[model samples]
Target: GEAAFAHKGGMHVNAVQKVVRSYEHIDPASIGNVRRVLMSDLAGRSNIVMKAQELGFKITSETPELKEILARIKQLEHEGYEFEAAEASLALVIRKILRHREPPFKIEGYHVSIRRDRAMTVCQASVKVKVDGVVEHTIAEGDGPVNALDQALRSALVKFYPQLKTVRLADYKVRILNSGAGTEARTRVLIESTDGKDDWGTVGVHDNIIEASLQALADSLEYRLMKK
Candidate 1:
């Protein structure tokens, strides 16, 4: 495959990706590798043919589906869902392949209201985030509704896991959660942020909005921090 990627320098990933730190100068993570998986070569899969057979995928190099799956995987990897982080993101995708049960977080309801008057723009955010199947929520006002909502939600989250301060919102994005509607359609928030040195994504929703945005914001910051 590196031969195919070789025609283009960018496909260099097909090589350094398999060798990680052994290659000089690439940030294992810049291409989406996490430190743990890189330090250990456990991420490589070569003798898994029998395992794939056990799962019932006919194991033959001549199998058109095998070639297609490999090609599709390398192609998706081009889009940035690096399966190396399979321990986290891809596990959810491979649940059927590995057969796991349940996921960690559930949302009850999250809401936020932003009001702007002559003097200032007010932001209030609130959220209901659950852990280990237990639920709790908090609401707060901020310099802007997003900040206040983040503050309020963080207040509750820290009580359960105090290590959250080590990380923060590296970036955030909100898209219309409801589509094809007019301006009134609520926006969907997709956040990309860091915890010291790690990055993650989270989502939130609401018509009132500030809290909904904050729901994803606070969760991304705190949960990622907790992970570190």
Candidate 2:
């Protein structure tokens, strides 16, 4: 007789044999359901291209632009960016590369400052952006450094890409990959953005948390525009 056991997570199983037999008829290598799990988490350009092709996206592994896109992903990852968690951003990048689309805006520089005055803390950010050879500088204040930076960046870019006004940051996350390195440890930043219709995630990595956040934020905006 098969004995039933209650699992820790409110799950119940009659026996391991039943579970094993259930999947026994399925080929491990050819299992469609587990294909995503079987894929490498640190997928490269080839993997991206393969995934895209599976979805009917017109791109070939042999394309020269594919190599360039992979190179760019590698360079960013070397600086601490992780794309596995932000596949949408990766897809946008591949699309832009394939279409040879121009970036909507170029960032020249940015400055963020946080100050505390007894009872109040203030955060400010200033950003410089170039669009069609014209440069714009804007400043904004927010509750935190990141928020301030986002506001400042948008203020500078809104005139050039008004579509940006429709986009909003839906979520943000940060993780330290190597806490043993303490303040110098690599930090990964993930940002989720939506423009009423679609949502996407972007990732960045850097020793500086703010820089990582900025990279993810920038990619999020770029992805939105490229998709549009």
Best by TM-score: 2
How accurate locally is residue 144 in candidate 2, as Cα lDDT from 0 to 100?
Answer: 96
How does each model score on lDDT? 0.50, 0.72
Alpha-carbon runs more than 4 Å astray in model 2:
1-46, 54-57, 71-79
lDDT tens readout by residue for model 1, 1-228 = 222211112223334445644443555456654322220122223212322443344554354344444444444444322332222222232332343334444556667677887898878767787868789888888776666666766766676667765556656666664567777776656565565666766555566456556556655653454344
Cα-based TM-score, every candidate: 0.48, 0.75
Off by over 4 Å in 1: 1-105, 116-118, 175-181, 184-188, 201-228
Q: Give the count of colliding residue pairs in each prediction.
A: 9, 1
Tell me how far candidate 2 lies from the true structure as C-alpha RMSD in angstroms. Answer: 8.7
Q: Per-residue lDDT for 134 in model 1? A: 82
